[model samples]
Target: MVADNLKRLKDEIAETASRFNRNPDEINLLAVTKLADVDMIRRAYDSGHRDFGENYVQKIIPKMKILPADINWHFIGHIQKNKINKIIGKFALIHSVDSQHIAEAMEFRASNNDIVQDILIEVDSSGEIQKNGIPIDESNELVHFITENCPHLNLLGLMTVAPFTDDRKVIASCFEKVRNLRDGLEIDGLKLPHLSMGMTNDWKIAIE
Candidate 1:
C-alpha cells in the first residue's frame, strides 16, 4: 500500500510540474514520516525513495538507527534551542528555521561540529497567528541575518504553509506571495534556489 501510494504521489507531482512547465526531476518529494510506520517506510525505501522528513529529533533518531545509512533525513519540524545538538550533523536539511535565535543556536552547533547545515527560512505569509513562522514582513531580515552572520548555516530558500481552507484562490495567493518573496530576496547577489511550499492539502496549487 505504501509503495503504491508513493508511486501515485510521485506521478501526481510529476503531472503538476509538467502543468507548470517545470522539470519533475527538480521537484523533490519528501515523504514526511511522522505518522508512517516502520514497515511503511521500508516499503517506500524499497521503492527507491531516499528522502524523508520528520517532525522531531526524538522520533527521527530511533528511525535513523533502524533505517539505511544513505537516507537523507530532513528535519521539517519546529526547531528548539536545546535540541540543536541532536540535529546539527544529522539531518540533511532543516526546513523550518524562522528566528535569529534558532539560527544562531544552529550555527554554534554546526560550527562546533565543523559542518555546514542547509536550511530554509519558514515564512508566515498566511497571517495565521497560530502558525510557526517568521512573519512575511520580517523574513527579509531573518534571511539577511543568516547569510551574513551564520557562516555555518546555508540559507537555501524559504518555506511557507497555506491556510487550511478549501479555497484554491486563497492557497494560490499564499504560495505566490512566498515565491515573490523568494524572488525579491535575492537582492544582494543572494540566490535562494529552493521554495519549500506545499503539503497534503494544497500541493497542486503550490505547483502552479
Candidate 2:
C-alpha cells in the first residue's frame, strides 16, 4: 500500500510539473516519513522516492541506516543546539532554519566537520505566533545575514507552511507570495532557487 501510494504521488507530481512547463526531475519529492517504519521507508525508496523528510530525530536515525546512501534525508523539525552534532552530515537539506542562534550553532558545528550544509529559511506564512520562523518583514534581512555570516551553511531558498484554508484561491495566493519573495531576492544576486511550499492538501495550488 505504501509503495502504491508513493508511485501515485510521483506520477501526480510529474503530471503537475508538466502542466507548469517544468521538467519532472526538477520537482523533487521529499516524502514526509514521520511516524513511518523502516519497511515503509524501504518501500518508498524502492519505489524511486529518494528524498525523505522527518520531523523527529529518534524516529529518523534508524531509517537513515537502513536506507541506501543515495537517499536524501531532510530535517523538517525544530532542531536543538545540543543535538546539532548528531545530524550534521546526515541531512541533505535542513528546512527549519529559523533563527540566528540556531544558524550560528549549526554553522560552528558544520565548520568542525568541514561539511557545507544546505538549508532553507522557514517563515510563518500563516502569521501565527505559535509558529517558529523569522517574521515576514524580517525574512529577507535574515537570509542576507545568514549568507554573509554562515559560510558553512548554504541558503538554498525559502519555505513556508500556509494557514489551512479550504479556499483554493487563498492557497494559491500564499504560494505565489513565496515565489515572488524568492524571485525578488534572486534579483539582488542572491541565488535562492527552491521555494518549498504546499503539502498534500494544497500542492496543486502551489504548483500552479
* Best prediction by lDDT: 1
Give the per-residue lDDT digits (tens) of candidate 2, residues 61-139: 8777767989889988888888889888789999988888889999999999999999999987657787777777888
> What TM-score does structure 1 among the candidates reach?
0.97
* Cα-based TM-score, every candidate: 0.97, 0.93
Model 1 pairs in collision: none
For each candidate, the alpha-carbon lDDT, in order, equals: 0.91, 0.84
RMSD (Å) of each candidate, 1 decimal? 1.0, 1.5
What digit string (tens of lDDT, one per residue) describes model 1 on residues 1-208?
A: 8888889999999998998998999888989999987888888999999999999899879889998999999998998898989998899999999899999999999999999999999999889989999999999899889999999999999999899999999999999999999888786688999899899998888888
lDDT, residue 2, candidate 2 = 84
Q: Which stretches of candidate 2 lie over 4 Å from their true place?
A: none
Residue pairs in candidate 2 whose N, alpha carbon or C atoms collide under 3 angstroms = none
Q: Which runs of model 1 end up more than 4 angstroms from their true locations?
A: none
